[model samples]
Target: MSDQYLVRIEGKNTDIAVEETQSILDAALRANEWLPHSCTQGTCGTCKLKVLRGEVDHRQTPEYTLTVEERAEGLALGCMATPRSDLTVEPLGNVSDDGVPRHPLRDYEGTVVVLDDIAANTRRLVIELDTPMQFNAGQYAELIVPEHAGARQYSMANPPTETRRLEFHIKLTAGGLSTDGWIFRSMTLGERVSLRGPLGQFNLVAKQDEPAILIGGGTGLAPLKSIVQHALVEDLVPELFLYHGGRRREDLYDVEFFRDLEHRHPHFHYRPVLSEEQWEGATGLVTDVVVSDFPSCKGMSAFLCGPPAMVDAAVKALKRRRMAPRLIFREEFAITPATSTAPAVL
Candidate 1:
């Protein structure tokens, strides 16, 4: 038998060759078949698909994400399952004609230019790529962590226009192979690293008319910063409000930067909320502050990024204020199983 098997995407005229050791999602992506996915790991169930035929090796698929019953029912996570034979799989999510632009995945080499401690346990990492990567604001890149034989995903903090230079806000995770073990400890300036470009579907929708409220927690502000910068530059929305939440003042970074931005744009507002520590700024849970600020979110859109609990709270808050379900977009920052020792932060 051939080492490679042809996998067909049900309902689409697409057939991609998948190596026995390669993931279905990875092979489909390389073949320019866009599948709904986040985390690119087995953690998120976004890439779960129905295996219409053939068998698969569900390598490293977490039981919490894909249960035994689901696997028995022919469901497999595209990101973790490797084809055992020729297969036909159907993505559970709809692949629609949404106007969002999809950029092909590519590898790039980058050198660390600036690495500084930005917040309490967060660091600002700037990498200058050899070639410009075209990506929508709020998309993320995966840094290859060869040391642990894995990769860590981080959103681009800089605007999409700054294609050559990418900025990432990395919160140090205890015992994390990419954070404490590498970036924060032994990594140095001018060190070259390999990374893949422009992953994730979370982004500022093009030509949106409703005002946008962006909420972020800790380093989750990275992608929201990119979205805010791009939105303000392009005037994509009528108004923009950004709320960065932290447990204390030490957890918040880039306060002055957003303040400066607000000062220049009359339609833009910035609020920094602290939950654990009392400050002159907005206090209490970030989602609570948003609720207090906006009595009605019926006509506005919201973007949220943070830990699962925070994101879940924000979503509930927005829905309570009558925000349409389709208008609310969120990205929950989480560490994959490989970095299980780390805290749940982007």
Candidate 2:
């Protein structure tokens, strides 16, 4: 059966429809509305809001982050909660001083359509959504695998225009939850799974004409790749230099894709770095490479996606080079199931 509801935010109203069983966050995101959130599995406080009127229920949530008093006071995390009746929600974004957008989290069921081993340790998986899901290219999704209470977050590897199909680059982690279903492993096509989001505030600023330095490490290359692809398609060709790093050559999955991008777009430059080996390519930590290659980012903006360590390192290096904190946009990819916990405060 289907459920319908009216969501009122900031004097604007939107009609949202959802499957009777889906969460409000899933439905709202499916409709293509911006929502502030991170770690859609209830870990990031970005989607929290006040229920001005009406009732809701969160089927899967980390209640530890919220006090019983808070829930009783009408506080809820939209990504974890589902509307049970017509609702008037004071979207988290509307009351924020930072201007971050709080969008509804939408749900989708996608079938694993293809899986390709792009590198020795990284595999690319393609899922075809039952219906098209619109989102900015760099946004991510929380994939819920059956039999596991936890969710895994991953960024899309394809351009937004390719709505029905979503691509992801997965790196095998020692104890990763989704590692059991690796694209290069025994997982088969046609297996269906549930997903939530289009979560994240990382996207291109429409009017910003600053040259962008794109930094990615390991499978973190997924979102950066999508952003670059979308940037090209949208004709926002600010001088771009993409630097991707890995421990060895095999970790740089889809390496050829970036090479082709540089060839196709004259304004693009590609740098692939391997730290543990001598392959005659750029050699050093990715951040160090950026420091030695483009030391001063005085008038440039930087975008980064990777492990927390890499993200932190890149941010520090950029700061030393005179890049503003506001000029650096980033998305840190969370891989383990347990890492998808919501924050106490957004």
Candidate 3:
């Protein structure tokens, strides 16, 4: 018999056919539906959803780390869970109501307007997109370098405006594609390249006097910069504390940019934390500083963008400070080679 199943979500019905191996999240994304997901292997609970009906058998996940009560309530991480029969599921949060774009993988060709080294490990590249692209602040784009197989994704360091140019701060990885391959390392002004994007949901929302905190490490400052600029342009005034951490003074490339912002907005404060700097400034792990500075982040919302270790540390630290888990948003930069086809476990 042909395998088929009917799934209902938020009062909408759709048919799904599984061949005993496909995950629910994969099938939903394949159908052009957006699901809140990260680390698609079940490390992160971003894909957690309420399994309203039918049974599901989830593959062993490194961090399926759910409470007993939570598991009893039919909650499953969609990335690892496979539907056993017809089902209804409630997506964790407010996902895009409409389906994603038909071509999720967009190709953008553009000229390099500006290319400069922001720091020893970071380079800022400005690309003027050939086509008009609209993306929320704190989002990212993937660049398909010439003669390379896998694309490199970077967050926009600037906010979206009517302008056609996009900026990215790329951290050079040794022997990594795009960065080590000399495409970005050897880029010059007015050069041409291809990119695709506007991915991620780490953008800010309109709120009245909400207290906000931002934590970043190394090049993770890219998306945080976009978020701050977006708020400034939109005139959304919120109490913000931005903590940027690096190993040395040189790694804290855009400290001046954020310092200027603090000067402009009295409600904003920028803290630069250097782990290995020889200067007399805030020093320690970025999250360690955040936790120490704001011992009780009880009523504030937070945004984090950085390496996996940093993101994980921030989450743990915030939760310990009595911050609401739902209020903390994050975006992680995943850079990997095409040769290693390891499945991303969220």
Candidate 4:
């Protein structure tokens, strides 16, 4: 079987070899070029492109991630999408043949520092890198598990600092390999793991004076939390609202920490929405709560994270509220066969 294909990005004057099983974003990033992307898991539409030529198998792409019009226009997500032919595409945003920070991939060693529960289905993971590593907020790294052939990806929940301590919010999916195999119960302090990356194009792009909107579902809060703190510290946005959702009250963890952030910064606000349980705060889906707060997200840059469905619905809702498609950013924690599908046990 043909395992590779050529990709020519329009206006970029860049042509790179893309493997049949590799993501275009992966190839670009490996080549030291930044593409507008996040999640890199086929959930975020940031890597969306207009396919001028060639074909792709979007079977693994989430239905909620792209719109019908986008599909009709021959668009596809670069992360989960694989080239089926020699291809050419027009990238949407956050790109340039030159300009913007491009951190070349590097390898590092790290020891597990802390593994504590942060929510009902989530855990707070802290890793102490042997050497200081740099990465933009919202970027993730692959944690190589000894028992697995492939590395599992996790987003850093903290902004860049001089320290090597990185944080992550890991959700223990039912029958999850890493969760069940090591992360949840078996992993121990001082355990060493191979780390590579500072990967993905999910970094923040601060637009002056525009209010930033962030929404997260379940453990999807990882990168968004990173982005939020980074934005506030850098003064990236004058004001912002973060809406986090879960099935129950327990899922909306870290409420107090966020509330403290909001208290300290008048321009920043946090709202927790629960679907299954009633609360004094906003109820129903997170997207609905955001819409109810503002009829339209005009002049706002919206960042969404979580499962494919939540990210999709939020993106659509923001668009309907007159938010430009370009203004919305995302990362999908999709429940795909590769990640979330549990095997039948008899």
Q: Which lDDT values do the candidates have, in the order given?
A: 0.88, 0.75, 0.73, 0.78
By lDDT rank, best first, the candidates go 1, 4, 2, 3
Candidate 4: tens digits of C-alpha lDDT, residues 18-132: 8777777667777776677755555546788888998976646777777777788899887667788999987787475433466765667899989888789689989999988
Instruction: List, residue by residue over 1-346, the lDDT tens digit for candidate 1.
Output: 4389999999888789988877888777767788888877778789899999999988788899999999999999887888899999999976776888888777789999999999999999999999999899999998887555577889999999999999999999897788988999988999998888788889995978899999999999999999999999999999999999999999999999999999999999999999999878989999999999999999999999989899999999999999999999989887765433211111
**Best-matching candidate per lDDT:** 1
Estimate candidate 1's alpha-carbon lDDT, on a 0 to 1 scale. Answer: 0.88
Clashing pairs in 3: 39-345, 39-346, 40-346, 41-345, 41-346, 43-346, 44-346
Clashes of 1: 0
Local distance difference test, candidate 4: 0.78
Q: Rank the candidates by TM-score, best first.
A: 1, 2, 4, 3
Q: Of the pair 3 and 4, which is ahead by TM-score?
A: 4
Instruction: Compute the lDDT for candidate 2.
Output: 0.75
lDDT of 3: 0.73
For 88-120, candidate 2 gives per-residue lDDT tens digits of 777765433354344455678899988777887
Q: Where is the poorest 10-residue window by lDDT in model 1?
A: 337-346
Instruction: Single out the weakest 10-residue window by summed lDDT for candidate 4.
Output: 337-346
